[model samples]
Target: MNRRTDETRPARSKGREEALDHFVATVAKIDEVLGAIKAANDEHYGTHPDEVHWGHAGDAGRVLAGLKEVLDIIEGE
Candidate 1:
């Protein structure tokens, strides 16, 4: 009889791979959102101070927080 060791084990399950893909895609989207927020801040930094004052930065912060939550969920899995 022959037995397999840890190094000879099969790859991860399909469900796990799918979950990782979903997590990676979500992270990429979060990065895009961050880039957009940074661009908005830069574009309006001097042009419209009122835009940042009117909760644009806060909105961006909220988005970041949501992204963090999603990442945490993925990590927990």
Candidate 2:
């Protein structure tokens, strides 16, 4: 008995292939951004402790919150 499912099915249209390709590319871009963020974080945002300010803290806080929201959605929270 053969059962067809998402894994066994092929993309059947040019538009679908394009959409899947775009989704894959967008995920790749997100991965690249995460890598950059990690590197910057390791460098302490390229600043001395005394040089850090409220504006920088706010920027980092916003990014952190955005990432948390994405995680929450993905985790079905």
Candidate 3:
């Protein structure tokens, strides 16, 4: 159908602009999180042989599961 007219174009463009701004902010936040994860990994944040325990494993498992879900969505899986 020919429902969209010139009048709607500006509204759609503004919506797109707002969506893109949100997307950029989200990506920046994700990047910041990834950097934090990398730093934690580099420092072995909770993996010390004497300090590690079942709780650490559980925490890692949950983090991995969450990351896997994000990766699956990013991969269009």
Candidate 4:
């Protein structure tokens, strides 16, 4: 005989859905930063590549790094 048990049950709560929504929002924000970085890098590379340095890229890099960490946390959980 085959029967289902509690061990094979699925989560029935709004918490998971809420978490997914939050993750999607966070990812969207990260995408926005990526877009900004691409735009800034393109403009700088085309007009002032020499002026682009660690100081200029630092903020965007930091944001991307933070987003990566958040994504890792979500995936880990």
Candidate 5:
């Protein structure tokens, strides 16, 4: 089955565009937050990250992996 783009579709609810817009905005926000986190991580841990400084690498890795999955879905890929 073929699906038309929003521009070709008749007038309807704004949900699709709104969702896409939200996704774009959310991605930007995520980038901003992640940037700050990386900055803090680099500042505190320097080159070698220890278990004591910054965060537990394993925990952060798990959370980031989950977030990447969700983001991939939201990005339609």
Candidate 6:
């Protein structure tokens, strides 16, 4: 058999492919959970804090949106 060249690596194994599939599924599950959380928060609108407006929670949607974008790039979707 011919040896591998310096520029060419061996083909990926099935195990690696399976692991990648699992990773994609896991990320998707996380996205689902975040969606649920956002929905729940949207449904109730939550109680007001003492003095401050608790602006951080207001940004959850934007934060999750950024994370989804990152995951999209990671999964090449």
Task: Output the number of the lDDT-best candidate.
Answer: 3
Report model 3's TM-score to 2 decimal places: 0.85
lDDT of candidate model 4 versus the reference: 0.74
Instruction: Kindly provide the TM-score of model 6 when superposed on the true structure, using C-alpha atoms.
Output: 0.41
Residue 48 in model 2: shift from native, Å? 1.0
Better of 2 and 5 by lDDT: 2
Off by over 4 Å in 2: 1-12
For model 2, residues 1-77, the per-residue Cα lDDT tens digits are 97778754565566688998999999999999999989998988888898999989998899799989999998999
lDDT, candidate 2, equals: 0.88
lDDT of 5: 0.73
Q: What is the lDDT for 15 in model 1?
A: 62
Model 3 clash pairs are none
RMSD of each: 6.3, 5.5, 1.6, 6.6, 6.4, 6.2
Looking at candidate 5, what is the lDDT of residue 13? 47
lDDT of each: 0.74, 0.88, 0.90, 0.74, 0.73, 0.73
- Give me the runs in candidate 4 sitting further than 4 Å from their true place: 1-12, 45-77
Shift of residue 11 alpha carbon in model 6, Å:
9.8
List the candidates ranked by TM-score, beginning with the highest: 3, 2, 4, 1, 5, 6
Each prediction's TM-score against the native? 0.46, 0.68, 0.85, 0.47, 0.45, 0.41
Candidate 3: clashing residue pairs, number: 0
What TM-score number comes out for model 4? 0.47
Tell me the tens digit of each residue's lDDT in model 3 across 48-77: 779988998888888889999999999999
Two-way lDDT contest, 1 vs 6, winner: 1
Candidate 1's error at 24, in angstroms? Answer: 0.7
Q: Per-residue lDDT for 1-77 in model 6, tens only?
A: 98877455434456687899999999899889889878867854454555336475657667679879988997999
